[model samples]
Every structure is written in structure tokens, then in C-alpha cells.
Target: MSKTVVAVFSSRGRAEQAVSSLREAGFNKEISIAAKGEDHKGGRGNTDYFGATMAADAGDGLSDGVAAGGLLGGLAGLAVGAGALVVPGIGPLIAAGPIAGMLSGAATGGIAGGLVDWGIPEAEGRQYEEDVKQGRILVSVQASDNKADEAASILKSQGADRVKTH
Candidate 1:
């Protein structure tokens, strides 16, 4: 699988610094930086909001699964899996019942779908989003497992105080 590893920095400049270091470390062509406000819509469309909302819904769905294990679980599951709710040829199946099924199915499908959407594995994407919400910057790289350590090493060398690999 093509994997993306992200290194979180404290500031946009620090992220840039890490990018520069990554370039020097031989990942120049593959590295990219997501600077704040660089791709903003002046408060209209917010990627962060979307990402965070998705994470929250997923979390809620998981919590519901642990709580009720039936109807609520299905509802929570749907909310969590809302990001992957797509209809091919037909329109969206917006009914609560089916939506709940989609959410319930998320326990399995959401993982792969989320990974595909975030460009990282499902577990990694959740963790990354959590870290970002806590005010940390994320640096992601896509490569083989062997290269993950080296990429992490470079980020840490450039002042990434805390690093998590998934």
C-alpha cells in the first residue's frame, strides 16, 4: 500500500522548516506542506471543520456501539461513516434506517474508506486528526514501511518533539 506518514510541528514556520529538512534528507520531491490560511475560503468552507466533524462522528458512533449495540449504535455508526456516504447512479440514501446501516457498516468499511480519503491508513488518520486537534502540526509522507523510520528520524531531527507512527 502507498502510505503517508505525517510529522506534526508547532508552527507553520516549523512545518516549513521540517519540509526543508525533509528535502535535505532526500524527500524533497515527495514532501509537501499544508500551511494555514494558504487554502482557506475566508470562513466559508473549512477542511479542518469537516475533518474534525468526521472524527467526532466516528468517535460518537464507536461510543454508541459500546453503549447500546443496536439502534443507537447504527445511528452513531452512520454519523461516523458520514464521510464515506456516497451513492452511485442513484441519489443519497438519506433515510435514517439505511444511514444507520452505513454507520454500522463503518466499523469495517470506514477504516479502509477513511484511509483512502485521508491518504493514510484509517487508524493513522484518526490519530493524526486527534493530534492536529490538540494543536500539533502534521507532516505526512507516503512510502514503504522501511522508509517510515527514516522519514520520522528526519522530522524529529528538525524539532518534532513528539512523533507518532501508525
Candidate 2:
């Protein structure tokens, strides 16, 4: 059996460490990380919101054209798995990791819906969405049942808030 683990962090720095820790623990294949703005209309997050920059060898950040409106400058010269995106109702978002695909997959549903689809309870999904909107970072990993405890421990050690299994 496998377990989907989710945790919320207060900042990008901690979020990044949790991701790296999970990877080092051998849960690298299906990790997901995401963040939302905390101040003003849109949160002002720098590129390293996830703690570490993507290695150049990881590929490249995705892009197309720029959108007008929020804090996101646009997806230009970004590291792999990171991009500037706009989430409906949340405005401009700078995200990395697997969340880049979740946000970019559709225009309307975006992260909150994706969170629900990922097996997070609807209420908790909305709470996570709101936390991100308020400048929080979230990391999730799919781990086998045997590794679930270890994964959650890694996240907790890195100051992950509300760490839970789905």
C-alpha cells in the first residue's frame, strides 16, 4: 500500500528543506511542492521560495507569453520545474516542482481542485489553498505504507505544519 502525505510550511525555505529531505530519504519520484501569496493582493515571493534553485541539468522552466495583473513577472529565465503562473481567484503565483503542471493543466480549477483530486479532504484542500494564498508553502509526497512514518517524520523535522496522510 501507498500513502499520500501532505504538509504545510510557514515559508519557502522550510518547504525546500522538506522536499530535499524527502528526496534524500528515497521518496524522490513523486514529490509535489506549491506556494501562495501572503501579503497584499498577491504574495511577493522570490524565485527561491522553495528553498533551493533547480539544477540546470533538471531541464528548464516552462514559458510562453506574459500575463498582466499580479505580482508574477512572467516565466522567463526560470529554473527547471519552476514558473510564473496565475491561479484563478488567487492571482499571480510563482510555483515549482510538480505543482507547475497542476496549475498549468487548466485555467479554472487550478491548485485547490488539484488538491482535492489528490485525495486531500475538500475542507483541508481549501485550507491548504488558503494557507498558500497567505504566503505558505506546501509539500506532498506519495510514499509506500512502510515509508509513510519516515516521510512524515522528515517533514515534521523540517517544521512542516499540519502534516497528515491521505
Can you give the TM-score per candidate against the true fold?
A: 0.44, 0.71
Error of 1 at 19 (Å): 0.7
Q: List the global CA lDDT of all models.
A: 0.41, 0.62
Alpha-carbon RMSD, each predicted model: 14.1, 7.4
**Cα RMSD for predicted model 2:** 7.4
> Residues 40-67, candidate 1, lDDT per residue (tens digit)?
2222222221121211122323223121
After superposition, candidate 1 runs with Cα above 4 Å error: 1-3, 35-124
Q: What TM-score would you give candidate 2 relative to the actual structure?
A: 0.71
Pairs of residues at least 3 apart in sequence or in different chains that clash in candidate 2: 36-132, 37-43, 37-135, 38-134
On lDDT, the leading prediction is 2
